[model samples]
Target chain A: MPTIDILLPGFGLDTDQGYPAFCGVFLVRGPDAAGQPRNILVDAAHVGRRPFLWTALADHGLSADDIDTVVLTHAHWDHVQNIDLFPGATLVVHPDERRYAHTPHANDWATPAWTGLLLEQLPVREVGDGEEIIPGVEVLGLPGHSPGSIGLVVHTEAGRATITGDALHFAYVATTGRNPLVFWDADQAARSIGRILDVSDVIYPGHDRPFRLTADGGIDYLAPFALTVTGAGPDTPGLRFADSSARPSWVMPGIQEQRALYEKNADDSARRISRVPRVVRPAAAPRAAGPGSG
Target chain B: MPTIDILLPGFGLDTDQGYPAFCGVFLVRGPDAAGQPRNILVDAAHVGRRPFLWTALADHGLSADDIDTVVLTHAHWDHVQNIDLFPGATLVVHPDERRYAHTPHANDWATPAWTGLLLEQLPVREVGDGEEIIPGVEVLGLPGHSPGSIGLVVHTEAGRATITGDALHFAYVATTGRNPLVFWDADQAARSIGRILDVSDVIYPGHDRPFRLTADGGIDYLAPFALTVTGAGPDTPGLRFADSSARPSWVMPGIQEQRALYEKNADDSARRISRVPRVVRPAAAPRAAGPGSG
Candidate 1:
């Protein structure tokens, strides 16, 4: 098997399984007999300490300008945010995506209200169901959570490896085979799962620790971390400094424990801490009696 | 002191602590010397389950159409979501607010994306600073969070009660005069707080419990379960919803506990729950990587 130097940049955890785990982006590089290397960011962490994505690449002597292309699996926020940061790279996306983002009222369960903002900013190219994004990378439309969402199949000697976006988020989903039905179309999500089971020896979910598939039709979604690319080729060696001074992405910390704490303590601190995002507020005004007074 | 009916509709613990809380609307009614009944909805709940500001009145056998006027505290999401729900109800907002919401880049923190959406749906009449919104109600430009955010001053026999909007979110803010400059323009927010303290004897904040200023200069915030609107005229009864369905506000249960649980356990739970609003599946492919990626 050839060596791919995969770099793992920073990511955020939605639900803390235990400690603060991370989502990762991988920079894949391997030397041919001629000693030339290929560079690709397998999956990028869309949220969290995002500047680190650029910094790490610059650290390794790579910058956005050096990248040839980006092969994306799905368009979830955590995986799609930094795409705009790389305005010069050719973006390879499933053809079905452009329509989804532009829908005045997105009907997809997985869509966010702000998703449109990202689409309006970048230059993207759409690929089809079976097209190869590049040599050794085949695009497979894995329509489950989304109609156009796809996964990338990287043909390697070790085995056919898959970047299975949210098609299979965690090992638990694969092991239990229990689909959460949170996808916009459950039938599509299920079909994608089936496609994933048939193609690769490994699965890289959008939000979870990656895992390998077992011979017995089970999945082992428990890998510690994967590597992603951030830097230019071997010519550069130092990382670039991104804007770290920006406001910290408001990560809701200890939401699960906060709920438990509130159950036990029910104090002011407990009340103040929660995992849910804040919505609207109402005035703390008293009720009116009739119209005359004021 | 005259008896006034006060209804404590449900609201947020976090976002409400800021300016949008000032966007509350309400119905102000006491009684004429002749005992004729009057009523109105001060600020309508923007949207969602808790149509409290409107439905609460309905539960009391009065419909929103019967309320005559829907007074807006400010034009923020939380205070403005349900403004359209009252079709025939007159929407009275400050003149500056109408202009601000219409301006391009009204303020640095202004959310212009949704401004056009709101304008298309509301029937609004603008009032100037210090202009009388009604016979007993007055609009005062408290501009701190935004250029046109206002506070509502209601004249009652109990002296003067000011609805500080985001002006003074907590009674403590008015008394100690300290602001928790988390997510807004600190300078403007501070100015709004100062102005609120200078006028009203009692400060009603958007978040914390509301309380009156004592002769000793102390402050008190009320607890949700402890608040009740007491005054009612002979012809007008205090607003009380005997039907729970009338209060369709969305309140996440065990959230404080959820936060505490996440903190205490800091375990696998954090990896499980998604706090961000889900994106619609099939967004446009991310734009090509920029020159920066190279």
Candidate 2:
């Protein structure tokens, strides 16, 4: 049976606010055709975070070279920057996405510099919609966010788990069916979201924590820190592990609220650091006035 | 000097209503590297209309093999079905469009059957946005009607002419800035239309006939049958060849009006045929009376 591990728990309190809100990277471990264990990486994070990604791999007793294959969900900067880290890995992307990467629209987040880098560095294998990348892993073309976004479906003992990169940005976006502000086609985005919801038992969102579909047609938010499933019962719909006392509802904060939360957290951290006393040697600096200071 | 000929004048009174309304194919005659005349076909028409297209080519003293290059604006079924007719031609398409042709969205007009045919048969050379396909021909990626739709800019003796395939469905849509009912992204379509207006003195629309942009930022409708510049002046802003007496306004009829016009035309054609004397069959013989009727 194949197993999945979260190298970084995507976009939550754990990630920096300035960077892309992504679910970092996921590593799938399974036996290859020769029955030897192989590791496949889902997406590489932002450019500056390569060291952190490497450390995470080291923590799992694996190195960059151990990554035999890397499947790109889309060609967005944050999701594809660290592709060069895995030198021996075979790169896979949707054919449409591969083309989009080369000539993205001006309004899109893609940059020519990044596109140039990708063309110069990576040898990519283009895959079609619903095609299997590996024996247990298949791709679903979900266009909207970009021209050629895709979702990965993995068959595991836990059932079908779909790694949706920006296709479903957060649980709130999926459950409430609110179109993301940044998208190529709103109608197509909505349709792709509906399609993803129909097939997957568990969904790993691009920017938020994972969630599972309950048997009774509701969602159960999985715990961010732990990989174990949490609050997964037919009776407990929309349950988040962080707050077990209250039933979960779609609670995506607005931009203002997010900024306020960041500011408040920064203030709190500053206050905690204020408790340490400073050295009293500052008083001597007042005697060194210049001639003009008279 | 290079010249252009309309192989099929897309959608008009001549085209079948049930089929695609498109400015079917264009032949641009220019000197090749060796200073010999060569023909570049802009797009290929629908599947079953090969004979009509062949006859049109023959009328112009050319054959399918005379087309040294076939430049696809997009991979829509109506625009790419007859590519096999010009086997010797080099196929040029936007990189984004080629990718899009491979993995089109379900809601889009792209069909898998057509896409499969294109992929299996065509050896495409992908060009980037603003990249030159030939010495005097440049590609502009216009993403709106489709994710990877493009326009061809040709520097001719008359002026800069843009072959816009579905980017500007009609001159009215372009001048009024009203998006066509069918489009991938309305905003992008509008922007692309504006961009096309800025660059080209004359535009060859995909569906409607060619129109020239006046210096005062108005459109002058070109005569479809004559292929001669009609009403080309800054004073005549909205000029339609259909009615030379009055300036043209947006004349896209509503569904009811269109249906009524079709019905009326069908009735008129039937009436004209009925005018031909029919063979007066002597009263059907008495032997035709059934025993029950008797």
Candidate 3:
């Protein structure tokens, strides 16, 4: 059987505090009974520590040609920057994501390579909810932040480890019972996070380092790390992980409950806001005015 | 001062449709001052019309190399399939759209080329809401279907024509004031349509043919084409363009009124719903019978 090596590509620092944000690259290699190696690279960095992905692959003495498949956790620039860099690698992503690529006025950050023009020329294969890309890796559809956002689960020798993607941006998101304000659908994200916790023992967030779920159901992190503001006040620092117990709440039921509460409230609030108004209020109306003016 | 010609590209329909969707394309010829004869292709086809664009260009005795600038009104798949086909052309788009391309799971109809991957590889330049790319063309930010959506206003001999992208998918969208349910934000789409109406006399929809906004504030067809829904329920024939007047009150004013109503009631309704109980009443639960329960 061919050996499988999971690679951590590089680390980037949050511009505000200079704390590091890890850029992760996963390399999956193993053989069927036929004994041929199947190689895959999942989610390359668009922001901090981006260069390390290329360097990490080089360090493994593998070129871009060595990667046969690339799976994107989501379409965020941070997660997909190195996509085009993979050259001819066949990209596997959700079908909803395919439509997202076409909507105009959508954001793509400032990176030049992350444009519609490049994706047009690149090779891509569309997958949908609950589908398996390979033997051990399964795609989970988690829409909210965007219609096609997804999480990936890998059944490993140790157990099942799931990459939560943007379903949970940081560990604290699950711990404090606070849903980060920056999301497309707060309710959908909450549901997705709940589903994620039910399925996996460990979670790797899109923005933060890997962490473990604690017995008390909390995300327990060992070391200090950079965090995202996420429309929450800046004081909430995203934590870094070192080992199995490093980030604990991910495995804890207590943390899961908190996340559930936050998700439910936040989502309801957003949906309420999106509906059309029954009465029109004048521009100068007071904030606490009763309904039915305009 | 380059000579420019606007050529419409071919359509991009699948075998399921049997024939290609004859979506329109426009070619812009650089003004007489430059004398170099620069050609621009706008809004490629969604189907069999691929060769149509090429043939139109060749009929004018020009090749792809003569093309210098390519701009899209928006990032729908039908409008942007063959973007890479224009190799050296400097692709101009709204900067906000660049970010939109990277947003996952939204606007699932776009081809990957219209998203981050294309932006990454192409020598693309970003334009702002009111920025001008060429002497006769100006950008107008129009958001609703997608966050970074934009329209292009071209000042020409034919009068000021605005390519509305998907802001007005059909003439009725503007006349009836009815925005589609598929929009990310229907209110935003309505506002954008209103803005586009204020700026130009001629309007071009993403689908269907072009039309002229009449002086009496009504939508009038510039050509003799009608909208037909092929796959709707059998009992009801889909709505047609010819059956309605230029002013569609239901879509336009009714929409505005609905928006007002929803906004007025949103907060109170939200608070009420939030206070509701999550559990259901159970018949089998130990109930107090007339004063005493066993």
Candidate 4:
């Protein structure tokens, strides 16, 4: 059995202001080659909040060095910034993705300077479609949002859970079959989405809550409430959740936002807090018997 | 003074049935560091037609080994396929482009297997925006089609001629301000086009026939007639020239189409010519007083 912990169930709340709602890191704790428990991290989150990654790991009674492998979905800047935190871990990326990260199109989001500097210090391994990194965890080539974006499918006790980094930005996209706003090839993205739907019953999107396929073939959001955008404008939409008036459980104070606020108003004693990254305890604990349950 | 030869004026005629009408290679004959005559090649056409490149070079009394340097506009497969032909030449590419060539997105037109193999053997030098690769030949960061797509601005005796590889696919795109159907970022492409229009007086596009700018800021096609796609459908259009009903000079028997034709009708005697790359002579010799002429 394996445990998938949402280290930071990233932004989807109206209360989350003045913070970059980019990405979250997930810790996949499973048995290694020798059946000993090993922790693998997916995505590193934006570079500005590296401390939050350390805090999130600490909450699970783990340390940065505990991560044996870092399976990157893609090399977009927001997802690869905190890779330095796991210096000893082996870095695994899709072959095309590794190439894309090194030589990305000008329009695509990539941090060549940062990625280049990190690769110099770490050993990187390339994985392709259907290749297994750990037992029951196979890599899926999901190209559309990127040339080399990949998804990890893990066979858990609950069911098969697929961790799709940006491949499916919002859980709603899976249900509607509409892709995210940004992508490399729209036709290919649409095809990849179809492939994802056929393979997995449970999905953890790059952003938003985890979702499960109901017996009647309907998508069920794990969170009590899910955010919905009202207007067609590209600007940030006013946040409102489905099925509830109260905020969702995953909302937490952003580390960089808090630091900036403290610097801006030094005299505000109430805002002064520890400078370390702290685990954000959700208001309502995630359902124990949900999709990601081991 | 330097000469700019349209080694292969890319497809526009309807006769090019089965060929990929994607790119053309331009030979910029200019003086190098010590005022010695140097032949610099901008972009190498698609890999499928390697013999055509050899024949084109031979037509100009030059050979593959005669090339002094190769300045890549970007790393798209169509533009970099024949890089191996210039083994001894110095390979200069935009730093971002060099990265892009290595790690291109899945949707982008990149032959990673071929590019990777070639890179392993050739040493590539990085060039940045506004940097001069040769005397009077400066590199401009024209990002849109690809992250590291660059344009070469050559100060010739005729005028300032900019070789925009795929950045300005059609002269109409520059005139109408509409981007090509294929692009990485639409906004960035528009900005790059504007920069090109401002800096260069004469332009040589990647796919279409070369066009010069008039005193009234309108584009003037160098050819007697040009091809225009009518109707909204994406399929191939009927060919017609702007000022004349007759076909313009540079149409040739497409190699891929000929191969396909030969395969379909094995007994066709006309199609079964010697399997060697032949020089495609223009119906009318190019003007000696144009932008590329020395």
Candidate 5:
């Protein structure tokens, strides 16, 4: 049987002030078709996490070339910006995702129109639901957050380990039975979460730590959250980590949320008072993309 | 005389692991043509910063309706995602930016092609470089970061204050004399930075704090950095901030950087080692578009 190692844990933290736009990067290692050991990276994180991703790989005595496959759960800028880092690997994505990137709607602010440019140039293989990337690691259809969002069902030694992208962004979405950041159908998103719950023993979310369903249907985290800051600054003194016990709430507006909010705010609306033109401060707070997050 | 207040500051923090997709949102309050009090928001930050933007405005006892005009520094999704929030405000963008957003290049990943869809629907008044949105608030041409990138030159009571979106993203770009994230022209970017230095007593960047030039040609930050985080979590133990002594470093890969790195890595190189299906670890880190400012 193959095994799974969570290279990093995703934190569930979003704010109204800004969006800490970080997702999970997973690495799955198992035997190839020929029974040879193979390494498959689930997602290549955006540019911000490259240094940390490299370090995470290094800790496991690995490098980008050691892997032979890169599976992208979706094609959001934050989820799949590092494909160039793995030039030798064959890229795996859903065909629907590839098609959607070509004509993404303006409301889909997360998908850059130019993304198709990169996707077109890369050597890619389209994988759909139930397709096996390798033995014991099968692709699962988990759309919602994106049109072609997919998940991975890895037959790990302990049990079934599931990795779902934004379809199951955080633990709350799973427990609440509602995916908050839906870009597609909300009902579809709910069904997708059902798919995740049906197959998952331990679930890894797109922007959160690994967790499992408790005996009484509660949540139990698999690991402690940890992060390291790279560039150091002053205006901020005594930098530390966030509190762990609290619920991880990602304050992002999905398509449905946006539509609802827009409809509400635009109702014969009149907005008020305000600016010295002071932009995002701390040179990073607004662009916080803090240590690591959603 | 009407004055300005920097409700927030932009950060100069970007990492390879993630792209803290954020920019500056400036509120310019002054008298209208009839000498009545008016507020013009320079840039409407993306969805990520809606909470902070709202708080920042409320600090002055203002709301979205108070904004009469919106000056888009450029059309990157990060700079203009929240335009829907200000329905009454007439948007001010360069005609060239408006045109370019119609068909952005694939390399310009920061620009979502659907951007044109949003730009087209807004109540827009195309402003060119050297055009005045209001008294003493002028738009300056500072292309290079994007095809139609522009800057703002505001005549404040203190002196001449300038807001350069990504043309002068950080202090290093100004001092180092080179923009690390150029999508248009390298030489043009250099010239744009020169334009910023020529007519400013103080500078507000897209993703860094406000700073001024000292007598000895050194940079001095005008204020201490402050940030408030919402929806705290655990895995992180200490809740502190960054060091002000260290220089701000945004580790994003520009088109040039990507090409250079791609070339260097893809030259008959075989890279190695790695994985489990573990994606980006944080709910926010992968999507770390953290707190106020860029």
Candidate 6:
């Protein structure tokens, strides 16, 4: 059985004025079938959280090399920018997600052009629905936020903990069928969320803390939200820590455009590979397909 | 002369938790020597700000193609991710910045592994210190946050508006003489900031709004901070907008390690190319050396 730790808790917050720099990072530790120690990192985390990841790992008295496998739920920038840091770890991504990343629309800012190529440079493995990452860890296909979104299910002593990347970004997703951001199919996204709820006893979201479903079907939060704002300037935010006492109504930017593009790309295959060079074909150099191959 | 508009006013705020998702996006609209209207976008905000950029551009009655050139202050992910959207515009960046981006440390999270490769796919024009990007805008070297960090100096009607990328991240750099983050050389970063102050009347920072130097050698902010937090979950921050009120003391992370790596790499040049694939050599496909080469 694997025990999980939230390396950095995700905050369900985004600024409409500019960027929303919040994403969750998890570390799962357990013994492999041979009884050897293993550390599996869930989500590489976007660049902003790099320092926090480092500190968290050090707090565990471990280094990046200590991480045996990195399971990326999705390739959104917020969730997968620090892949390079874990040089010794194998990256486990969905096969379809890898191909999907190679065909992101130019407007899909979340999937930058270099996404596919960067992943190609490193060691990787394709793990999809019903796949076991190690032992007692199962892969769940949670597509909707992006074409190839997936989640991981880890069997723990407490119960079944589902590490959802963006499939269930916030606990609110359980209450409201709508996710804050969606990149692929909303219908599929909804179904994925439902699937997550069906199997998950304690849910680990992409942008929020862990929450368990109550017997009456109510959601109970396991932690409080904390986002410490640094880089203070003269006219920037006056508050160092984002005040959690109050918040605004969420706005879904380009959700319609995102869905329309998904529809458009489904109709036209060529547009799918439009930006593959960065997200396109990647380098001419042959890349090792699986992270374990290295 | 180019008239500058803060298409999206940058908020000087970043959460210590995960990612700092704030970078300024500026639109410079004016006429070329031929007298035709030219729109220049300074700094392509990270994925988080893509919507803000789109909405701002749309508000300006323009689209991505409407801009003729994109002047990147630096190649950090936060400052330059949406370059693909402007398919037709030429990218203006410092030549050394491009090469420097080709070789960044693996731990340098600000400069992701894919920074160089993505820019290689775009139309680029290498501009350097004292070089004119247009008739009035000049490229200035500001290599601190990353080796290739550069700022742009534009001849605005109000006076010279220097677009300082991570060179001078926050306005407080003017008074405190220390940037919150420094990647390449702290000395060079400091010098670059001094140069920005020496040559500019108004300053446009990478993560903050535009400001002017006060008559008594102080900073005069032109705008208030506004970072609207959305996706309000049941347990997330109660505030919709990041409160710009009392802040905590900023802690500097990995400064010593950063400088140590700089010295170590300075001793062993091989370490310079550690993570250049994403920051590495990029693809086997020969990239056009300059954005103008496209």
Query: lDDT per residue, candidate 6, A1-294, as tens digits?
Result: 789898888876655575565778899888887888889999987777777788999998888878889889988877877877776678899866776565565557678655666666457788879998768888999988787898989999978999999888878778777766666767888899999999988999987789998888788988875554444432344422344433333434455565466545553333433322321122344675886785
Fraction of native Cα contacts kept in each candidate?
0.02, 0.00, 0.03, 0.00, 0.18, 0.50
lDDT of 2 by residue, A1-294 (tens): 677787866653110001223354889888876778879898886533454676789999998778888888887766775676665677888766665454344223233212422422445677878897666778888876665788888888888888888878676666666445433565677888898888888888886668896777576877533221111211223211232112232222232243244344454333322322211111122477878987
The digit string of per-residue lDDT tens for model 3 on B1-294 reads 322243552211111101123446677665534444556666654322434455676887877566677777666545554454566677777655555454322113342322443333345677767887666777888876655577878787777787777776676677655555332456677888888888986777765457786777667866643222221112222211122223222222233343344456455434433332211111243555775554
**Lowest lDDT block of 10, candidate 1 chain B:** B13-22
Task: Provide the lDDT at B278 for model 6.
Answer: 25
- Regions of candidate 5 where Cα sits further than 4 Å from its true position: A1-9, A13-17, A25-158, A164-199, A211-228, A233-235, A238-244, A248-294, B228-294
Best by TM-score, which number?
6
Q: Candidate 4 on B1-294: residue-level lDDT in tens? A: 666887766533221111233476889987877888999888876533454676788999998778878888877656765575666677888766554443333223232312332332335688888998778889988886666688999887768888998788767667755455333555677788898899887888876668897888677977543222211112212222132223232212232242243234433222221211111111254567978778
lDDT of 1 by residue, A50-164 (tens): 4456567887799865564666666654455455445556667764554444331222323333443444334557887778655666778887565467877777676677776
Model with the higher lDDT, candidate 5 or 6:
6
lDDT of 2 by residue, B1-294 (tens): 567788877553110001223354888887865677778898886543454577788999998767778888877766775676676677887755655444333234233212422332445677767987666778888876665688989888878989988887667666676445433566677788888988987888886678896777677877433221111111223211232222232222232242244344454333332322211112233566667885
- The top-ranked prediction according to DockQ is 6
Better by DockQ, candidate 6 or 2: 6
Interface RMSD values for the candidates, listed in order?
A: 25.4, 34.2, 28.2, 25.2, 12.9, 7.1
- lDDT of all the models against the reference? 0.49, 0.60, 0.53, 0.60, 0.68, 0.73
Residue A281, model 4, lDDT:
15
Which pairs clash in the backbone of model 4?
A99-B103, A100-B103, A103-B99, A103-B100, A106-B147, A147-B106, B4-B292, B226-B241
TM-score, chain B, predicted structure 3: 0.65
- lDDT at position A45, candidate 2: 62
Model 2 per-residue lDDT at A153: 87
TM-score of predicted chain B, candidate 6 = 0.79
Instruction: State the displacement of the C-alpha of residue A236, model 3, in Å, after optimal TM-score superposition.
Output: 61
